[model samples]
Target: MQHHRGRTRIVGALSVVVATLAATLVPTVAANAITGADFDPGHIISDLQFYDNAAMSEAEIQSFLEARVAPTGCVTSNCLAAFKMDTFTRAADRNICTEYTGGSQESAARIIYKVQRACGISARVLLVTLQKEQSLLTATAPTSWQMTASMGYGCPDTAPCDAQFYGFYNQVYKAAWQFKRYSTPDPWGTYQPGNRYIQYNPNPDCGGSWVNIRNNATAALYNYTPYQPNAASLANLYGSGGSCGAHGNRNFWTYYHGWFGDPEYGGLPGVTVTRFDVANRYESSTRISQEAFPSAPVPVVYLATGHNYPDALTAGAAAARQGGPLLLIDGASIRPVVDAELKRLRPQRIVVVGGPESVPESVVQALSAYSPSVTRVGGADRYEVSRSLALTMNPQGPVNEVFVATGSNYPDALGAGMAAGYRKVPIVLVPGTDTALDAATADFIRRLAPQKITIVGGPVSVSPGVEAQLKTFAATTRVNGANRYEVSTNLARNLYATQRPTTVYLATGLTYPDALAGSVLAARKSAALLVSHPYCIHPSTLSAITDFKVNSVTLLGGPVSLAANVKYMVRCW
Candidate 1:
């Protein structure tokens, strides 16, 4: 059963005459007092069948009554006496035996009396018909009436007696309303209201026998004296007496139920209240997730540099030969060396990788002559070179191809190539210290294939055999020397100026992670820096310098910078 709080009704003031009449009636008259119309005397009589069958004792009845009654504020001895009389009168009606077939009827009468005295309507008005049908005490013989009572209907002992059943709480509410309808017309009226009467006789044609039964039922229930009719008193009566009162004693009845059950009762609609509570519970239990990208089809590119042309070769290789139509360049200027390699391997772009001082006037002049498309990019003091062999490469887009410039004289190219791959840019490393063709270079040529390889460094480390293996892969070969800072700065300037896939490799000895981090910080664009020694600075300092756009910082090895650079790069990424 879905439990809910029910509504409440208020009683009005009582008149002096009614109070006087109620006071004179004592035990015999009190049982007939009116409480309300819906009290169902017939149902009461029926329910009492269980009590009559010895199922419930007198003590239990008294206890039930006491538990259900609300305390009345009436302090006068007369009022107290009247109240006691009414209680006894109802008890007697409920306790009728064989010596009194009508005893149960008397008990029904007394109940109505107390209800009317205490609540203000006759028992008939309260619908207490059960009192007429069954005795309050146990019956020795089983009867159809008892069966009907058990089924919630109170059937009178006489012919044409039909069963009438009403739940206990529902009766109380009906009784309260009956009292209200009766009281409103003449606030002090002792007579039952004609408008609220019900004809219960099956043979209504028999001079309205049902009306007499109803009248007698009314008299038996509400025998109380009427006084000032108070709505508060009535509310207390309805809230405290009858089935609602009994349920209240059991702690089951609540105000919400009454409000919805009774049209006159007050409260918000039941369904709405329930829904509000459910919604609150749902909101408390759930959460939501969000996606990183809402749009699509944007390009992402990575650039790398070669050993000799550390920065340029890496960038060029990333942009051209490794991918597609995009351009890559190697900035190193060993043109004869790079051109021969370029002719043999044919990289899509050539970026001359070098330090700040590496771009000499002569080399620049040669580049101007050979590939005027080669553009100087980055800051004035430190710039790298971007040689667009063909199509212009956009640094911001995704990288697909790679180009490489190699030479035997510069062992840095191998490190540059590895660094490029770390940046997700694929590359080819070329070998040759000069523009010469040698078997050693040929061996280097053999080693530079399908991507992965290790180039061990040593004093005077350009292994000719390694150069030969590198030649097999060298798309372009360039040679030049410049300070690490100049190379980095030039790379940054050129990247900003041309906005192409570019790389700047710092010269071995001069490049420091700290200085490179600082340059990166200063140039907040998309330029990639290839620092040979990332360990020259503390990890914390490097962290702060490369905090933004950290993806652009690539580490190359320096003699003293190896361990720290390795540690920082491994952890930071």
Candidate 2:
């Protein structure tokens, strides 16, 4: 039944042909061909039993065949199989008269339907098999022997075809029965799941791969042809390029796709999404932490200044290490989101990471409502706040590494936050657009004595003088981009080297609060946090998502903060 010419021999669970093709082989002229086997191996070819064959009439199959214009020059609606297939009374015909509608011409469609019902095989399978084996359906001028072995029922390449199974009715019925037998249990059955050593070609030297058969239809195809297309064969569509590769299965896929759209239609693999529904980013972070760290108790939650970016900028590292989310609050009082999350988390202690000025004493009093133990680590200004937070997180000694960003702007700091959090290293803020490092930041950097320091933004945000000063304390490395979006994408790429995260978070790059709170959430899940515009995804960010193959994306804020179109564009990836 394999589409090959000459010297066919059955050798140890393989049906192979030892001769060359009959020159009729040609490449299918089509665009968007499946150049590679990227599809899931378990994909179903078709739902064989999904079609209602009983409702199908002979007139329908005949009309369908007649409508298809043949490859050879022939009169419209006239072909050899349609007009002259039923020349003799076969075993299928007797049953067709008894069970199916009795016909006088013994039409081609009637034989196919009778064989389909008789052997419990699909008519579509028979039609495809017929064309595949002998080009019977599309060939305008076929030889008498071609019709005799229309389905290649009894043809063996080693010898002449067995004459007993000659004629269209016998061929179709026997072929359908053979396909049915493949699905049944037997010692000779090749359609079974397990490690199957399928050869790439008839030549023993060509070698093969171990394929794990997942379904009956794919098994049947392999059982019929007994060869798989190798990588070289697939590289060029026209032919195997003399590299001893089989084309039967490859042609089957190509033809099936051309005839019908995705052969594995409804059985494709699915993506998984983990969602967090909260009133704001405050609750969003807690919900994210709760989901990500389900078993971790005694979490060390970081309380940051919601009004400004200073306190929150340096808190990512500590929160990540403690397996907790950043809880943002107003300078005066605790937000309800933080209050509810505190009760839910029931942390042993809270590390408030800002000064009394940045996070007032009233907020500290309100935090004590949930936890009896609350420690405040802050200073007189933003730079001192960053220094105090770092020192508190690493009280034993100076940390080995730290990320430095502009205290005035949120983008650069937020861009570097998630990565810093993942590494559990603090983010120290420097004065933005300043000619030199402020006295507090400089003094703090000299004390910490970090081995490595990453400058997040360009010279415009943190000047060369500050970077040079930072270099005096540590091995300074700058991560700069043309803009904020590029910076975020570059940082994400560096953080998640080869790991493709299933979930990623997206927030507007133009603003900060949404992304500031979102950074901790994304870091907790070991996911990437990307920044984009309100209405559109940045090109570089979108490219990263596609390359990573991220399944689901969490938009940090509502439509106002991150526009509806941004979510739509991300989901499209």
Candidate 3:
């Protein structure tokens, strides 16, 4: 069955609309950048954004039309602003659509609202479609052809406009009806919400790509237009893209964003965000560990001090290599809850990281009650502990690689931990103040003889002198940013963006417990861990979703770790 897209371009049509807009209307303020790559062929616009009936009231629609043209500008009497028609009532189509009321001597705005109320299609969509099809909204001299083919309802490319559908009320009703009609179970359109090959131009010779259409709104737009803009058209959004360009859907997105706002931004929209949290950070670890090891026996469980986060960074990497969970415990003695969890996990051995000073000898002895074998990997300081764990975790010589970060802070190393945990390697902590890489840290890495070493922060955190020293050990790559936020995004891009993982773990960048625990969970889930401000999500963090093509985010902790408002920001911003 053949159906019509909204309309093909008529020369000087959109230019008139653009000029009218620049002269009278306020310029469009878009929240996100309009780039070709960010264009989700699958999700051009969300269903909620498309079917919103109350998107505009009668007054707002009238105001929009009035602003575009003036009384003196009109060469004819029957302009869109002054157009009036008698609208008939529409019956409900069961689950397909709702009913619309009829009216006599109704204004164009009133007709649009009634039709929208009946069909559940947005008035904004109707308004934009008017201009996109015939420049009806801004034309000073409204031609008979423009008014008759107002919404471009039944005007197929190879045939003349059907006389029966040639009226203001007729076109608006038919267009809105067609949009809702395309959503039915036995929809009468070629395109639909799935993998589809959409053409760049009507001429099949121009070629196209397989687009994963996400919803009815996007599919409806394609069914109406039947073509996507080529790279040349996308490259020149405001103007022309030579002969291959198609402007129907492109103008629809542009007009909506410019006049109203982000088509998908009225509510918390785009992607799904799931939360994984509990009373405290300790539970977050145990829960994730249980998820990773559901219905299976654990070989080992690693313990690190809850008070300090540095040791856990390296310990996490080692624990991951051994298919174990890194549990946080009090420095003086293990918590009763942790002890209880230990009994439940029932590991063959318990490996306690850091020296007795960090985890007292009494605690080590107490751990033995749960597991017959209790091993202690102690070092004089955090740096030493990081090195010790790297070697102990990998009995095999020349492991894949290791991550090196400053011991002074946890942010850089936190990112390093995720990569290491995922790769089942190690993360070594180096003293940032040391002008040269310490012999101890350097020598421990030399023994591992990794193929590569990634420095997690800039010179301030891990100085250039140290980076040079590590190069001697293996091929060296550095992941850094102006602040911790940039480092996290860069690491996420480097690690997981290639495969385009939709799901990722988000933790507050201000602290370490949630991210520390979440890193292992991310590794277990085969995802990346990202950090941001506790309340307002960072710009970089939000933009990363579009750049990386991530459609799902899992926040690791409760409001205590990341505030409730952060959830809203992740989607809207």
lDDT for model 2: 0.64
In order, the Cα lDDT scores of the candidates are 0.27, 0.64, 0.76
- What is the C-alpha lDDT profile of model 1 across 1-573, one tens digit per residue? 111112111112111212222222212111223444433322211111111122112232333223322243223322211222212222222112111111222232243333433333322223212221221111222244332342122212122323233333223323333333333433322334232332221223311111222232232222121111122223443332222121111110111112111111111122110000011111111100001111222122122122223334334233322331111223344424334323333333334434445444455455443332444432221112322211133334334333233433233443333333333344333333334334432342333332333232321333455444444554323222353323333333333443442322222334322221212212222334434433233333233224322323332322233322132232222
What CA RMSD would candidate 2 show?
Answer: 17.4
- Candidates sorted on TM-score, descending: 3, 2, 1
lDDT of 3 by residue, 90-183 (tens): 7886665577677888998898877877787878789889987877888866888888888888877657777788888888877887887788
Q: Of 1 and 3, which scores higher on TM-score?
A: 3
TM-score of each: 0.18, 0.51, 0.54
Best by the lDDT measure: 3
Q: Clashing pairs in model 3?
A: 5-224, 42-214
lDDT of 2 by residue, 2-23 (tens): 3222112222312211121222
How much is the lDDT of residue 242 in candidate 2?
Answer: 49
Runs in model 3 lying further than 4 Å from the true structure: 1-270, 570-573
